[model samples]
Target chain A: MGRTLAEKVWDAHVVRQGEGEPDLLYIDLHLLHEVTSPQAFDGLRLSGRPVRRTDLTLATEDHNVPTTPGPITDPISLTQVHTLRRNCEEFGIRLYPMGDAEQGIVHVVGPQLGLTQPGMTVVCGDSHTSTHGAFGALAFGIGTSEVEHVLATQTLPLKPFRTMAITVDGELADGVSSKDIVLAVIAKIGTGGGQGYVLEFRGSAIRALSMEGRMTVCNMSIEAGARAGMIAPDETTFAYLEGRDHAPRGEDWDAAVASWRELHTDEDAEFDAEVVIDASELTPFVTWGTNPGQGAPLSHSVPDPATMDDTERQSAERALEYMGLVAGTPLRRIAIDTVFVGSCTNGRIEDLRAAAAVVKGRRVADGVRMLVVPGSARVRLQAEAEGLDTVFTEAGAEWRLPGCSMCLAMNPDKLAPGERSASTSNRNFEGRQGKGGRTHLVSPLVAAATAVRGTLSSPSDLEPLEPLVPAADLAHQEA
Target chain B: MDAFTTHTGTGVPLRRSNVDTDQIIPAEYLKRVTKSGFEDGLFAAWRKDETFILNDPTYAAGSILVAGPDFGTGSSREHAVWALMNYGFRVVVSSRFADIFRGNSGKAGLLTAQCSQDDVELLWKLLENEPGTSVTVDLVSRTITAGDVVAAFDVDEYTRWRLLEGLDDISLTLRHEPDITAYEQLRPAWKPVTG
Candidate 1:
C-alpha cells in the first residue's frame, strides 16, 4: 500500500500501535505558555509526577503578557506572569520571560530559535503549534490534561488521521502572495474541509514559495480543519535552516540536509483525498460571512440567501443582517467599520511592509478604526526600523504593541457588539473578534486598502504610488 | 464528573472545517466561570436563525454530534467541550479530531470518536437527509454505529475506563492515596509539583 507524506511521518513517529487503540507516540518537544499550562502543572502536582524531561520542555509567557515593554498594569496579568515565572523556575524548565529579546509568541520563537527543526514531534498547549509543521515535523496542540500527559510521560496516545493533498498548481499572479493563496484555499475548502486529515500542500506552486511564505501557509492549516499542513523540506527549507541558532552547524548541516531531502512524498504515494487549485485563477479574497470559509473574491458580490442551501439560507440572511450588508451587492462595496492588520497569521515584518505600502500616503477612512499590531517584539522592532509603524500611524491607524491582540479578544483588544472588521487573522467565526462583532478575512494589503476605503478592497483596487521618502528625509522636509 | 450516562437524540451534521472552540462557545460565555449552564451559548453565533440546525425543532433534542474532520481545532478552551456536553451532545464523531479537543472532550466525559473520512461523510450525509436518525456511540467498544456502518475508533485505555466509570482526575488520584503519598515523600521539599 502506498503512503502519503502524512502516513510516512506518522509511521516514523509511531512507538506502539494496537488494534482499536490509539498509538503512543513519543513527543520530542513540549512548549508551554501561561494560559494553558497552569492547570496541566497542577495536574502533575496532584499526581505527584515530576516533569519527565525538563530539557525537552520550554516555557514562555505570551497570551497574558502585556504587549507594551513596560511592566504589566493589570493586577491579574501581573499575577499570571509571576505565576508562570515561579512555576518554570521551580520546575527547572527554561523560560523566555517577557522583555527577553528572544521572547515572542511561542510559535514564532520556536522556529526563529531553530528549535522547530524537521522530524520532531512538537506539542504545545496552543493551537498554532501547527505553525511548526512547515519545517516538516508532526506538531499539534494539546489540552491541559494532555499537556500534563506530555510533561509527565513525554508522550501522547493519538488516533491516526487520513491524508489529504492540497495541490495549488500553476504560478501565482503578481502581488498574490502566500497569504492570499492560503485565504483562497480556506475559502474554497471551507472551514471543515480538511478535518480528520493531514494536508500535504504540494505541486509546483508550493515548491516555489519561500520558507517564510510556507510557514505563513502552514500556520493557518488548523483554521481550515486540517491536523497540520506541511510542505516537503527542500533547498528553500535548507537555506532557511542554514544559519539559525539551533539548526545543525557546519558538517552536521550537510548531514541534516541529506536526511531532510528525503522527507518528501515518494512518487508512488497515495492520498485519501486531493484538492487541486489553479493558483493563477485566485484573487485577493475576503469573507462576507462570519467564517474564514465564507470568503469570495473581492470583486464578487455578497451572496444572497435565497440562492443558498436550505440549511444555510437563514444563517446567510442573519449574517447579512448583522454585517449590515445587502444581498447581491458587490463585496468590494461592503463598508467596513474597522481594519485590523495583525495576528499570528499576518503579523510578520513582510506583512507589515505589504500593508504599509498601500496605506503610506492615503489616510484611512474617517469613520474606520484601524489598528496595526505586530506578531512579536522582534517583528515590531523590524517594522519600526523599516518605519512601517509611522506609515500606519500617519495613515490614521493606531500603532499597537505585540501579542495576540485583535486576532482574538483574549486581551484588551476586542470588537464591540455589532461592529465589523476587516482582519488579517485566520478565523472569522461570528464574534471571533468580539461578541456580535463580524469579521472579514483578508490579506494585509487588503486590510490596509479596506482601512482606506472603509470597505472590503484589495490592493489591486488601489493605484500604485511613488515609493515613500525615508523617515529621515521626511523629517528633514518637515523641519 | 458523573458517569455511565447514556445519550440519545437526533444528530445534526456540521460539515465545516476548523470549527474551533471559539465558534463552539464564544469567549463572552466564558465571562461566567460557572461551567454548568453554558448550553445556551453553544454555537450561539450560528443561532442567528430561528431555524438554525441546533435551534431547529427537528434536531433540537439531538445529543450526538456528527462533525467533519479535524472537528475541533484551535484553542484548548474546555468551554467548548463543556458547551457541547451541556448542549446535550454526548459524542462527537469526526474523521479526524484535534488533540486538545479530544482530550478536553474525554475529560468532560464526552466521547470523541475518530472514524475514516468516508464513514464520517456517509453518516453526515445520512443525518443531513434524515434528521431524526439516531447514531449510537459506544465508548466501551470504541465503536460508532449508524444504520449501515460500524466504525471502530481509538481512545486511550485510561480515558475510556474513566469515562465508563464516571471518574475524574481528582477522584482517580484519590483512589490511590498510598502510592501518591509515597511518591510525594520520596521527592525532596525543594522539588514541588503543582497540579
Candidate 2:
C-alpha cells in the first residue's frame, strides 16, 4: 500500500517500530506550562535527573497569569506562577514566566516565536497543543505522566494510528472566515465525527487561507473529534516562517524551505477515510445549541424541537431551556449577556483587529459586558501601540492583558452562573464558561457585532470600516 | 470462557466533528468520581435526539469513529473518552483528535488513530455502503485493514501497553507502588515540605 503523508512522517521519525511494541519516536519540540509542569519537574527532582534535552524543551506561564500586569495579587495564582519559576530555575529549563514580555499562552507564544514549524512532532502538557498543528506538525497534548516521560527520556514510544483526510474545496464566500469554515464542518459532521483519525485539511479553500487563518482552522480540529488537524507546508507556511525568531536565518533558510517543500502528500497517497466540504456553500456560522456541532448559518432559525428527530429534539429542548431561548426563534434575535473576544483559538492580534473594525465607532449594548484579551504579551503590546485598545475601550469593551482568560475557567476570568455569552473560543459545551453558563460560538466579527447589539450579529450588520490608511500606502505600512 | 475474542482494534465511524467533552460526557454525568457509567452520556446532546447516529439503527454503535478534522477540541475532560468507551467504542479514527482528548483516550483504554486525509477518505467511502464493515486494528502490527486497503496507524507506547493488558490507569500506577512508595520514604529530611 502506498504511504500517506502521516505514514511517511511517522516512518521517517521512527527510531524503532518494535514487534508488538510501540515505536520509539523522536520528538522535535516540547512545550511546557505552569499548571502541569510543576509536578513533572518535581518528579524529575525526586529522581535526581536533569530535563533530558533542555534545548527541545520550553516553558511558559499562562493559565494562572492575571489579565492585568502587576504582582499577581491573587495568592493562589501568585504561588502557582512562583512555583513554576522556581522549578524552571532549579532545572535549568528556559521559562517565559508571567510578567515577562515573552510570556503568554503557550500555544500563542509558540507560533509568534516561530518555534512551531512544519513536519515536526510537538507535545505539551496542555490539550490545546493541537494549536501547533497549524504549522503542519504532529503536535498534541501530553498528560503530567507523559510530560515526565518526555522530560526524562526525550523520546516517546508510540503506537501507530489510523489516517484520515478532510478536504475543504472551493473558494469561501467573501465574509466567511476560517472560524466559520470549521464551525460549518463540525455542524455537518456532528460532534465525534473523526474519533480515531488525524485530519489533513486539503484543497483550494484551505490552500487559499493565510497562515493565521489556517492556524485558526487547525486550532479547533480537536473540537471535531480528530487527533490533530494539519495543513501541508506551502508558500504561505514558508512566508510565515521567514524572520521568525527560531526560524532558520540566512544560510539555513533556503535549506529549511527546500525540506518543507517535500512535506506534501504524494500523488498516489491514500487516506483511510475522507470528508469533502464545499466552502462556497458555507456562510458565517454560529452555535444555537450547546456543543460546537449544534450550529447553523447566522441566517437560520433556532432549531425547533418539535421539528427535530428524537435524537436531536431533546438537546434542542434542553438547549432552549438552558439558553433561555425559544424554539423557532431567529438566531439573529438571540440576545447575549456578554461578549468575549479572546482565547488561544482566537486571541491573536488579527482576531482583535477583526473585532475592533466592527466595534470601532460603535458602543456596546447597554447591559452587555465585553472583554477582549490578546493571546500573548507581544500581541497585547502591538494592539496597544496601534491604539486598538482605545478603539475597544471607546466601544465599551474591557482591554485586558494576554492570557488564556475565559477559554477555560482556570483563571479568574469566568462567566457568572446562568449568564450567556457570544464567544470566539472554540467550545460552547454546557457550563464550559462556568456552571450553567450558556455559550454561543462565533467569529470575531460576529463577536464584535454581538457586543454592539447585545445579540448575535454578522459583520454585514455594521457599516464598512473606515480605511485606517490609504490602500496604496498599505504596502509601505509597517505591520 | 473459550478465550473468545472476535474484536479487531477497529472503532466506530462517527462522521461528526468538533466534539467537545460536554457532548462526549456532559458535566452532569461527571458528578461522580468513578470512571464507569459514563456511556449513557456519550453524545448526550445527540442522544436527546433519537435520530442521532448513536441511536440510528444503521449506525447504532461501532468501534471505529471516522470523523472530520479537530475531533476532540475543547476542555480537558477525561470523561469524553470514558463515555466513548463506555458506549462501546474501542477505537476512534479521525483526521484530527484534540491533544488533551487523545491523551485522555489513551489513559481510558480507547485507541485514537491518526490517519492521513486521503486514507481516511478511502476508509469512509469504503464503509459508507456497509455500516457493519469490519476493519481490523492490529495494535501489534500498527495497521488498520479493511477490504484491500491497509493503513498503518500510531499511538503512544505507554497507552498501547496499558490497553493491550486491559490495565486501568489506577492499576498501572499501583503496578509501581513499590517504586513510588520507596521514593516517598527516601525523601531527604533536609527537603522543604510541600504539597
Q: B25-109, model 1: which lDDT tens digit per residue?
A: 7754643323468788798878876766777778888888887655676666776887888888888877767656877888778
The TM-scores of all predictions, comma-separated, are 0.81, 0.74
lDDT score at residue A239, model 1, on the 0-100 scale:
78
Worst 10 residues of 2 chain A by lDDT: A12-21
lDDT (Cα, 0-100) at B67 in candidate 2? 70
Off by over 4 Å in 1: A68-79, A466-479, B1-20, B28-74, B83-100, B112-162, B165-195
Mind giving the per-residue lDDT tens digits that candidate 2 earns over A1-479? 56666676676666544366566666678888876666567666776767766777889888776686576776656666777788778877888877788988899998898888877788887666878887778877666656776777655666676777889999988668999999987787666675556778888999998887888888887676666778888989889889878887766777777767878778788898888999999888999887777899999988888987754676567777878788778899888889999988899988988998889988999999999999989999999999999999998999998898887665777788789899999878776776668899999989998898888899787666565787668877755
How much is A298 displaced in model 1, in angstroms?
Answer: 0.6
Q: In terms of DockQ, which candidate is strongest?
A: 1
* Model 2 lDDT tens row, B1-195: 011122463434555545556567654454333446878767765677776666756666577777755666666656577677777787777766765677767755677878876777778777776666778877776778987778877766666666676654433333443543343344322211111
Q: Using TM-score as the measure, which candidate wins? A: 1
lDDT by residue (tens digit), candidate 1, A1-479: 66666666677666555566567666767888876677667666766878877877888767765454577776656666777788788778998888777677788777767777776678887777887888888787766667877777666767787888899899988667888888888777866677667788888888898777787888888777777888878778777777877777766777767766778788887888889999888778778886666778888999888997753575567667767788889988778889988776787777889899899889999899998888777888888998888888899999877777787765677889888899988877667788778888888889998898887887777767777789999899899
Candidate 2 segments whose C-alpha is farther than 4 A from its true place: A306-311, A463-479, B1-73, B77-195
Index of the highest-lDDT prediction? 1
Displacement of residue B168 (Cα, Å) in model 1 is 8.4
